[model samples]
Target: MNPVSETQSQHDSAKDAFFMNIEDAYLTALKQNPVVENGRTRPQYCYYDGPLTDIVLHNFIQVPADNFSEFFSHNHLPIPELIAISHEGVVHFNEMPADIIDEIHQQRTQYKVVDYIHADSFFADPLLALNVAKQRNRIYCGHPTIDGLQICYYRGELPEHGIENLLHLELDQAIEFFVDTAYRLPTKIELPDELEDELKTSIRSGFETIVNEVKQQRRTLISQLLAQAKQVTPKFHDGEPLKIMLPSSRLTTVMQYCSRAVAKAFEKRGYQVWFYMEDGEMETNNLIKFYRNYIEFNPHVIFYVNQLNNLALNDKVTHISWWQDSMPQITEHKALRWRGNDYVFSISPVLDRHLALTGAKNIVRQHFAVDDEIFNTDGDIERQNKVVFVGSSYLNSVDLSRPEQREIVEIFIDKIDNGEIVTEAMAGEIAVRFGLPPAFVFWNLLHYAIRDYSVKWLCESTAMPVEIYGRYWEQDPDVAAHFNGELKHGTQVADVYRSARYALVSHPFEINSQRLAEAAACGCIPLVYDCRDVAEKPHWDDACLFFKTRWELLEILKTQVRPALSPTVIAERFTYTAAVDNFIKHSNIGELSQAKQSRISMFVGR
Candidate 1:
């Protein structure tokens, strides 16, 4: 047989087996709750029992076997007679007993899986389910069922059920599939306006509480900053004005910590430092307002982070942009954007070379250091034996739902498996096809895949107790099981680093991450990804333990990763004080230290 015909046959056989299993499960559900004479022929709502049902509705199993006829009496909704079936007292997605499965196979009735997990199993074949759902309205609902209804609705996939307010069902658990009878009977699949209003009220109250908590945290951070500033020693300089340009208009907790540290460091160095930024705003064309602030502040030097904005730069004002991701990770467009700037700063050597090709006058290689005041283990307690990872999910930036991007990423992974790394140019071609920015496409998909795979491998392979603290990871059951908890910025993070045996640091795009430096500052041993070409910085020497593969990392973990004195000793070079000294020497800023400035200039020139 031809390859195509064989593949088709395999798929057909799989589909047939899946249908058999689902049919058996459905029949078993019916057998438990026998509908009276002709009840099978009569229209009724099928409510399959699942673990989530307990959390979603109070006594859902006790929710009148009379269907929803009396429950939704006053509403104009087509409340069908409900056939409620309890699974052999199962809570999660697991195998039912063989007798129960046999019983289900004996019964002959269409049913729906109440939980999303079961829905996935039943709707394994989208085309088959879509056709079946359309014909009989008694098949597993795929995208429009629950997960991607908003996307499907917007894409004009299923308009037959015109933008149904999913809350109308008033059940906490997602309804897996709907039979045709449910939609055909002109059912108002929406909560009544009053009930919706009540739901909104509850949601609003919860949101407000969270908002208040965040505000309190911000206020506390500000107070802590004020206290720390008083303890900072101010050194005398001829008084040069320095302005630190932030990466974002809105500062996250970590950004706020870094920004404050830099500002304080400069303040201590006798530079009249100010941060000129509008919080929570992204105004690319706000040059007028920016210039007004510059005029008021009258800053001599400006250090921008992440991206270089198109600003009117005069000889009097030194425009320096600190870029992190460089060549092979970032597109040429990013390098081009830095043109017209006075100086370009980068941590990565590849980025420095890439920016040099842009004809940038001064491309200085710098490091993203840790703030001693924020992340040091000065008063830290004894460390535990837990291996912790503190970082955000890599998948946040990528929209994996996009088929074109997903297909490209799949191909990219295959290439990686074949030992061929994807280049920016190759990623750019895929980006062009998808009408996406090449840098974003490259980093989002490739970097995301790298981190995702590495972290999963670490948690699964390591012998030590692994704990991850970050956002969006808890959404995956496999990954979530390893999650200890989330930690906010500031001392909480420092405590996490100090308390853990080793902080696992993995950055796909860069050789190093801020976490590596921060972990070191907190006297935490950093177990890093071994990529000497990327991590060519000599500063990492004697400061970190490296692993080229999962097995190597696992071996390190088994050996009991511990704090080495070198990490803490080497961490001093990455402090805010060292960072300020480096900045002054490299940029030729301030009047006090000509000898120091000359030495730094010569070092940078190398």
Candidate 2:
């Protein structure tokens, strides 16, 4: 109404917009900056970092892993297959297929790196629907592969140094060039007594000197990736997401969640976002409507988050196709892969190595957030010596055709029960012929079966005392067969847990398990297997004994685990509030508090 008021309103709106971008920018900058020595680069990919992650700095941490980020007491968790890609031209392929895994061991290969840059991109079907058409194809992993995570970089003209001609230096050589490079600062090549004597003046100066040297070195490496990013002839990338695509079937739910997190982070910031789940509906009429407005509206930015890029998502969108984890096709190690986003996000803290590789100067760490709402309800902490599982029914679907493998599982199961191991024939019949893998495949599997099996087995094994409870086990026949006819199914799990002492956790090979949290909530002190490939933590050690092989289970049975939990503590932790909060805080969404929530919010209008 009044001129003065209008002016102020406009200024404030502009200010908010500016500050928001600044926040995103500042956070992004953290990725390239070294945690300690500004010179040493680590990729800030995933939230979890330690001796293993510190080895080679990653950039922004992948969102899903960052969400449920936790360290086990023992390094006994199973590592999933991950895909990782870095600025350094697809660095390491760690999470190889099982056959490749065995071959690597058979050859005793300490480490081997593979690169599949041969793939290229080509667009087809301009208005191809997102979800529908793909489903009709009835297949997995068959989309045209696009290299470079879909994002393209192009600076106007060549800057004297041709990118292709520049010898691609090894990362170490690049880092070494910065660290140990011969710095002839117009004086003696060697820092003799003069510089050595300077240390006596102030410790700060000595540190500054090291810092300055590293900074200069970092510049050289950045120049390599950017100025030297593939020596193609100088041209402008009016680039768009190519029609090219790839099947993401193998890319687990964790991958989907990470992409969602990454997309949402940007959406909250004001960038218009579009994520085409293979199942998303993008049929022509809608596609045309989406396209017409995209062109008519002429949005400010277009962002893409996926395993590829370079396709035109309606030419007007400022397409930024980024992979949030390790390029799955590249890095085989899931941990390393999940942590590496093809591009960068604002919620996570980035490691320096990746910043140098991507030549990304403005990078930030966006972490997932804890809701504190899900774990809000009260739980009747069952203090019983029982185990419970609350996940998939995979255990009941084993295909027992593989008797040999079945034997291993039975042996594993027997060890799980402190030696009342199931015979191969028994396990084989239950797994293969019974339409499943093996009942005793792992800690995760153990979670599904053992609650009832342990209870039944204990009932039969030694009267050593046991009870089992879970969602699906009650519906199982094996448990029914063991039934001297005790209560089965439903809240019976909670009942058994309430009465039990040692709450068994089917943690087996996973770095993390939902059961661990559930058991903790139910006040069941878990008998957990120590998985090594993931994080190791304090309470984990205090709470559960970490074991691997069945033999280790014997040691656990003899010690570590106890019979009961203080009922009060169980109520405190397992309450819906605690459960939800822990899941949220530890989950990737927790990192969103630290990220630009604008990304996810942006898509809302779309």
TM-score of model 2 relative to the true fold? 0.31
Q: Which ten residues in a row have the lowest lDDT in candidate 1?
A: 147-156
Residue 594 CA displacement from its true place in model 1, Å: 8.3
- C-alpha RMSD in Å of predicted model 1 compared with the true structure: 19.2
Please state the error at residue 342 of candidate 2 in Å. Answer: 3.7
Off by over 4 Å in 1: 1-248, 251-256, 279-289, 325-341, 399-441, 539-541, 561-565, 590-606
Clashes of each: 7, 144
| Candidate achieving the largest TM-score | 1
lDDT of 2 by residue, 124-175 (tens): 1111111111112111122222111111111122223222211222222333
Question: Candidate 1 local accuracy as lDDT?
Answer: 0.51
Candidate 1 lDDT, 505-573, residue by residue in tens: 866435456788888888778887665544555636566887656666778888865544557765766
What is the TM-score of each predicted model, taking all chains together? 0.52, 0.31
lDDT of each: 0.51, 0.34
